[model samples]
Target: MRVLAFLDGTLGDPSQPYVRVDNTGVLRGDGIFETVLVVDGKPRELGPHLDRLAKSAAMLDLPEPDLELWEQAAQQVIDNWEGSSEIAVKLVATRGSEGDPDAEPFGYALGMEIDEKVKRARTEGIGVVTLDRGFGPDVAERAPWLLLGAKTLSYAVNLAALREAGRRGADDVIFTATDGSVLEGPTSTVLVAKGRTLYTPPPTVGILPGTTQRSVFRAAEAAGWTVKMEPVPGGELAMADGVFLASSVRKVTRVHTLDGVALADSTAVHAELCEAYEAQYA
Candidate 1:
């Protein structure tokens, strides 16, 4: 792992602990983050990631992100990382110590090799189980403090959901709203295909906007596949011709089984989208 911690206007080592104990981000999980895939020393979809990071920071009322500094830190980390064909560059910003709410936000960028499990999931479709998120589709609009759309550092619940799925003998989870509307995976966006048309749940459902999903939709559209964003019921997964969990690190990964029921063979669509996804980075 290679990391570049941003201090004032300079970068420091991340392996060394630099965060103070009183930091609000550490104490209360008050922070925002973005993960980008770095290939050939270049962070893919960097602009989109930074834009989303800024939006998340704004939602949290943190200091405006200094994109130039973040970019510099990311480049430094990428340059330092060795032999990792697909490195994950994570940019994070945290609210400073609780005592000083006006203090500058702490920020850092880290680069590390992709996990072997994630790589295997990309090639071998994963089994997913649906878990209820216990929220309604209109929660984000009705309750701003919930921070539904922001990619905050408070991922305890998400992690627990994945663990629950693992306990159920599934590889991942797709969260659903109280009304049984399929929202998204713990760390990915949900995509379903029926013939040549691709469907994804809209952000209006209180899910985070997916940068990778947007890129894949664009590529799919160019390849003569129709793309649409609408509410997907939990039962729809069983009826779709194919289903996938798309993310920056995982790319486009097929979901072989949903709740122990095998989905229609998506080998052809998976191959098509995988090629389209790789071409974007190529």
Candidate 2:
């Protein structure tokens, strides 16, 4: 079932048309959003996701979000949910309508079912291909205009990359910077394991600070494993004892193959991390 809640404190049927076409989110793509996990009616890591949404708004020069309004909207949808399983909630805000400077930002929270493929990734893992993101490791410092940290609605490039990945006969893509350093996936963050240690690229590398990745780090540490936030070289993808992509709804998924080459067996590390992560939420 589809559910929606508006910023003006009104709940609407998500299947019906509500968002006007004149909004900048439709015309010029001036908006930000967060897709969060709702399991058994409770939103996990919701506070951090809200905080990140605010940061994204500030980066886009958009008006500050009314977090209370957004939170209530989310709760409204959760309350309306018809199932007791895991669901995805997208919190969104656009720069209002076009040709109206005085218009306040338009915002809402939408609830939808998770994709079957995403659910499958949790158990069967995924095959990924590496693609160049056409930027360097210094992108954050050299080109702050990119706003790579924000989860904006201008996702045409990300969507195109996924299409390219599909054409390449892979389920996903891992982007590498111009400097040949590993960056992140189109919709997830990269995590590598070596022995009992875990590593992920730092935020300074122009990647979004992943909320799920952070939780996974804490989970790993709690399990007596070392966690490091550092630059990951592209070559290390193959050499690492285990490689995984981390996301909110999908949680953690091992990279079964990279460019058609089988990855090192990560079952031990995968299970330990998953156990710790689920326990953290439980």
For each candidate in the order shown, give its overall lDDT on alpha carbons. 0.89, 0.91
Kindly provide the TM-score of model 1 when superposed on the true structure, using C-alpha atoms: 0.97
Structural similarity to truth (TM-score) of each candidate:
0.97, 0.98
Residue clash pairs of candidate 2: none
Number of the predicted model whose TM-score against the real structure is largest: 2
Q: lDDT: which candidate is best?
A: 2
C-alpha-based local distance difference test score of model 1: 0.89
True-vs-predicted CA distance for residue 28, candidate 2, Å = 1.2
For model 2, how does the per-residue alpha-carbon lDDT over 1-282 read when each residue is reduced to its tens digit? 778988787899877887788999999889999998999999989999999999999999988898998899999989889964987999999999999989778889999999989999899988999999998888787777799898899989888998998998899989999988999999999999998999999989999999999999999999899999999999999999899999998899999899989999888789889999999978
Off by over 4 Å in 2: none
lDDT of 1 by residue, 21-41 (tens): 998889999999999998787
Global CA lDDT computed for model 2: 0.91
Clashing pairs in 1: none
Which residue runs of candidate 1 sit more than 4 Å off their true CA positions?
Answer: 7-11
